[model samples]
Target: MSAFSRFTPLIRALPSTVPFVGPEAIERQRNLPVKARIGANESGFGPAPSVLAAIRARAGETWKYNDPENHDLKQALAVHLGIRADNIAIGEGIDSLLGLIVRLVIDPGSVVVTSFGAYPTFNFHANGFGCRLATVPYAGDREDLNALLDAVKREDATLVYFANPDNPMGSWWEADDIVAFTRALPETCLMILDEAYCETGPASAMPSMQALIEQPNVIRTRTFSKAYGLAGSRVGYAIGTPGTVQAFDKIRHHFGMNRIGMVAAQAALADQAYLHAVVGKIKKARERIAAIAADNGLLALPSATNFVAIDCGGDGVRARAVVDGLMQHGVFIRMPGVAPLNRCIRISVGPEHDLDLLAEALPQVLKAL
Candidate 1:
């Protein structure tokens, strides 16, 4: 079974791993159907009717490859954000864009800075590119802004990944603080400000587009995957100065975006009213998730995203047991991957019936535990 072995040394040295073990894989491995299906932070509220209509309307165009330039989506985003089309770079999702960003700046052994337990996809991309990762531990369940800045300076890191309304913990800093952080970063160091959950967070937590759009060193990434209910579609974009974003054009896959997905994202952006309605539903679901945690005598950490991290009142072992117990009842959920943070099981907000399944299963899981 031996085959050609001319792969790069970095590729040969890497272990094969998925950043997140998806719920589908869990179902196949455990032989259990997922009743709630809220483990991966997808919007159970679903996309706007308008978005679906757009998809249906454009399904006939599936044979055509999406514009390599991503012109329509970029133009729509430009009008929406009040920025020029040149200021935006489109990608399949923030995950895809992270890889491209790494390729743009990181050489083998180049240092990349990030939070210790933040989003894992960015970390996966950094590793894939053979960059060294410098991680800063969370300070009080939030990314330590000061420590991240310090690490970037000390290492003169090639790239830094930071998430606003961060995942796993669902914590965030105010927009003003984020602006200050961006201002303090050295121009030579590139910063990726991931705002995937921005639509679900407080308005005060999101920095205005004008604040950092002009900074060539800063790239703010947002996605349709969260509040807009388009996780499967995988449409996201990066905002930065013209010179900065144009870098993507050099190496990006021409015509990489899906036609239907592009249509879905464009429709999602145009229907602001629908977006607001879905956001309201998401807010209520977050509250219900928190309430379910409270009912089980666990503390639901303060959340600014579509999910809540409920402290299970014990160590990783206890939290893991609860997660396993719930899955046994077809109530799929997740927990953080690292210590301290793994004490909490992360639950994505779903419709009432999904929460109903959770509400029914959680107590029994705890009682058994």
Candidate 2:
């Protein structure tokens, strides 16, 4: 029963862990069905009908491997963003792309700077590469840009990960502030501006593509998962200088993009009207979530993302109880893992029926506590 002993030192040294325990896993472990699946920040509004039609139309072509160059998707994105196709690199999702970014820049013992409790998956990628993490605590529930810069300079870090309309807590900074932060960083430090939630945030919160597209040390990542409702497709792309993005071509899996997923993304991109409509729905859902929190006397923090973080007015313990109690009623949700931030429970925007489930279960959960 002995296992093979030839794994790399880094692999052997690392503990087995997933960045997030998915809802399906929670359901299996707790032996409860999830009635309202809104925990993982997924778009419960679903993709556009055109996107579904595109998938169905292309399902017959599933046997063919996707184009390694990702030509059509890149071209479509280029036209949409008013950028060149060469400036883009496509991946399965932001998560997979983060791993690639880490591999490209990090060596054993290299320093990686990030906000404490920012995105755990980025940390997972950094740890897998044997990079030492330098974390800065959040300032006023937002990622402290000034402190993050200081950490990068202090540690001489090689890579830094930041998210706009950040996850878990759902906070964000104005676009000008972000551009200023990017300009202030050491050119030696690569910055991953994870904009996975960009489409759902305010226009002022996103820097124009022309602002940082030419910055060699900066890579902006966006996904079809949120506003576009294509999480299952796993399609995401990075925007960077042509020279910087081309590096991905050297090491990326040639056919990692799936045919159906590519089709879904392309269709989703073409249907801007559908996207705008969904964004409106997402806004309403966020309001409903906040209203639910208010009804129970909890403070709902302002969010630029698809989820709302409701302050449970207690520490992680009380927040965790509400999470567990809601789950007991088949209403699945999540919360931050660190202190202060853990005082709030994070809930993703879903359809009215799902939010209704959350609304009904939340007060009952809090009452029980």
Candidate 3:
């Protein structure tokens, strides 16, 4: 039957695509069960017991719509970050907030800058908004800050997306360098510093909140997904100047925060002890993943995120074979999508049992190749 033909030109012009093909989708498409689910950078360590309890306590209250203001979460985050509540804006996750930021700043034909193979979701959002993309290739397997800055200037771009402890390749820059990059950007260009993995990275890798919190042009996006083990909750917040963050209220989905998710995030925030413990576990898991790569003679790149990107020592074709071969054994993992970077396969930190599956499958996969 024919579909309605009233969609906007931008919507009609964009191709239907998702930034990442999730593991569940892989299972359905390939008809294989995932034994070790470590591909999407999710924390397999799980949320704190206290957070689970909080969700249970509030599950009965699910009928109630969440506070549109997101009052308690904002207050808790403000106290936790030593910033004012007004300086924060909560969203479903960094992904939703990125789309909102793009909507706020980008118009048709506006220019948006990002790393060539960085987070693809930002690019998806920019394309949905009909903005032109200006990409900078990775330098030393890391996002090239100098080139990104140059691109913004050259294109007169309105928006730029950058991630610290970046995904896929899992590379990062020191906090000082990041601070310098922020200061160096054109005031007219809004910078989204996606710090979703900040808690798992080295302290030296994160800029002091005070350093960028007041910059109107800079918005640091963080999530409860990584270190807090709350990816399912979809709770994320943006930090920026009060005036800048206030703009979200004008366009944001009022009442978008889930009640139980808010409760879990609050409970997670209150239980910093559990957070510290999980971080230690994550560090150990990262080491185990790297050791597994070394055992097979592949090089595991240094990572500040929860995942390790192991260089398969070949092109994208070889890396893809390892990914598919591992999946045949029910050990699911992922690899970068672009060249040079695509030579590496990305694995998220999971419990020892999952790594055991990986360790067993990886050698066999490489041997077959």
Clashing pairs for model 2 are 92-234
What tens-digit string does per-residue lDDT give for candidate 2 at 63-144?
9999999999999999999999999999999998999999999999999999888899999999999999999999999999
Decoy 2 TM-score against native: 0.99
lDDT of 3 at 248: 98
- The segments of candidate 2 whose C-alpha lies over 4 angstroms from its true place after superposition are none
Note the residue pairs that clash in candidate 1. Answer: none
Each model's lDDT comes to 0.93, 0.94, 0.94
> Considering lDDT, which of the candidate structures 1 and 2 is the better prediction for this target?
2
- Model 3 stretches astray by more than 4 angstroms: none
Q: How would you encode candidate 1's per-residue C-alpha lDDT over 124-209 as one tens digit per residue?
A: 89999999999999999999999999999999998999999999899999999999999999999999999999999999999999
RMSD of 2: 0.7
